[model samples]
Target: MLLVPATAATIDRRLTGRSPVDGRPALVLLDLDQVQQPADEVADALARFGAGRFADVRQLAPERPEAPDMDGLSLLSDLMPQVQKALDSGDASQRQALKAEVDAVLASMPEAPAGRDQPRLDGVLKAMSEALAAEDEDAKPS
Candidate 1:
């Protein structure tokens, strides 16, 4: 389990492709400051000290009623494979067309409410755009 000060909404980023050192499933504990209960506090402390200290920790699947609608984020994730495919084809015109499509989708996405996830989402989107631009440069004939 990874304990981070970041909001829980960004847990996806932390857990993606992560593997446990002991072959157990990885878990992420977010927003340590928000932990309210004594049991949780002890667990958090133990986790911070060392994960190996605990012999058995029950994994609880809790519902996130506060999770924001992430349809735009999902759409962006879906578009990435297509973007890579376009890049792999090495067709300049196709790349431009797909870039335009991405821009359109980005422009059309609704403004997310101001919160912990919003900045992270914006950063991810910006990084994606910048990466595409970089890839475009790399693909150009020298």
Candidate 2:
């Protein structure tokens, strides 16, 4: 796998939309070389950017040998549409209901067989997608 240097050009477009990054988001500069990198490295190079700051590798795994970040490609593809529907429906009740469904999926992981934690992550991804779809209840109503 190649090392896709986390440069200013690598800022995730999703983050930039939430808060316009002046240029070259912070995460772009985080150094992933400090870690005991895997043979296949699979560097993520997360840096301070968008709504947050501080840089770190998001994850390092051997199974995925992609040098370029694949964070945008979520495993919960099936659940994303449900999340999008809830968000666009303008139905708070529907969104909350979806969140509960997502939580239940996550909490079920403890009973899952060991070494199968990927399913747990799948649940987390689904839950987060649902939550992200929500209008921040604390935010003044848009």
Candidate 3:
């Protein structure tokens, strides 16, 4: 009936009866570290109780993987503001040049790890594309 973080301190507290839900029955503690997995752990646990109306299940946390190094993408933090400024200026030539520069920077940089920095990179690209698209729309005759 309770979903909690898979940390040593939390497990210790729960095991020592110090948790707020200590006295509650039908407690299921699960730790999922998979990048993709179904959300049926609770349902499976409940099914196992089988008409007992009460059960307690606990799972130890897995070792966490190290975060991917994003040093190569750090320059983006500086470049993004410049890009934004160029977009706001509404100068087609400047925006085009900046886009080329940004594209070159991105191409030279190392690929981001899946499910980590990819989303961030995609987001930046999307923002740039949207700004350029808006600029194009504004240039069109009414």
Candidate 4:
């Protein structure tokens, strides 16, 4: 008789739920490393990051790695149209407003250790591309 390994059970632990604190935007950053980490370790990181800062977080086993809810997906979906406009119009002012929104989302992350590289979030990339293009054009020595 052949023996087969049993599949791992899914874990769905929510550290925090959606919050409306001061009407500011909420952000969730998944600690990808935690997928393989022990529950205690994952809980510690969640506790550290969710102290009135992060709006939601969860740790799921690899067998069932999935987002807890559609809130984040909804946020990205709503922002895509605005991002498209900013990218198409190449408008600095519009990009600035969108950048502020992105900032609010990033404010949920814990302060990085000194000298650590910052993780680039989406939506900001389009603005960064626009800025770099302008710089390149300026340096063309026309």
What Cα-based lDDT does every candidate model obtain?
0.61, 0.50, 0.59, 0.50
Query: Candidate 1: deviation at residue 102, Å?
Result: 1.0
Question: Candidate 1: where is the Cα deviation over 4 Å?
Answer: 1-65, 68-70, 114-121, 139-142
Q: After superposition, how far is residue 79 of candidate 3 from its true place, in Å?
A: 1.2
Q: lDDT winner among the candidates?
A: 1
Error of 4 at 18 (Å): 40
lDDT (tens digit, per residue) of candidate 1 on 1-142: 3432324344444453223334433455543456666666667777777765453234544335566448856876788788778768877777777777777766766777675355455555666666667677987789
**Candidate 1 C-alpha error for residue 87, in Å:** 2.2
Q: Model 4: how large is the Cα RMSD against the reference?
A: 17.4
Per-residue lDDT of model 4, residues 37-99, tens digit only: 785666677658666433232332123434433665666677768766765776666666776
lDDT over C-alpha atoms for residue 82 of model 2 = 82
For residue 117, model 2's alpha carbon misses the true position, in angstroms, by 9.2
Query: In candidate 2, what are the lDDT values of residues 26-142, reduced to their tens digit?
Result: 322333365576623333332223223432223422355336324424535656788788777778777778777767656664554665444445655665745654464733465
lDDT of 3 by residue, 1-142 (tens): 4443434333433442223344432224433444245546554656676445433444433436557447636666777787788888988888778777766655665666676646466567656756765786788799
Candidate 4's C-alpha runs over 4 A off are: 1-61, 109-142
Clashing pairs in 3: none
The better candidate by TM-score, 3 or 4, is 3
Candidate 1: minimum summed lDDT over ten consecutive residues — where?
16-25
- Give candidate 2 regions above 4 Å deviation: 1-75, 111-142
lDDT comparing candidate 4 with the true structure: 0.50
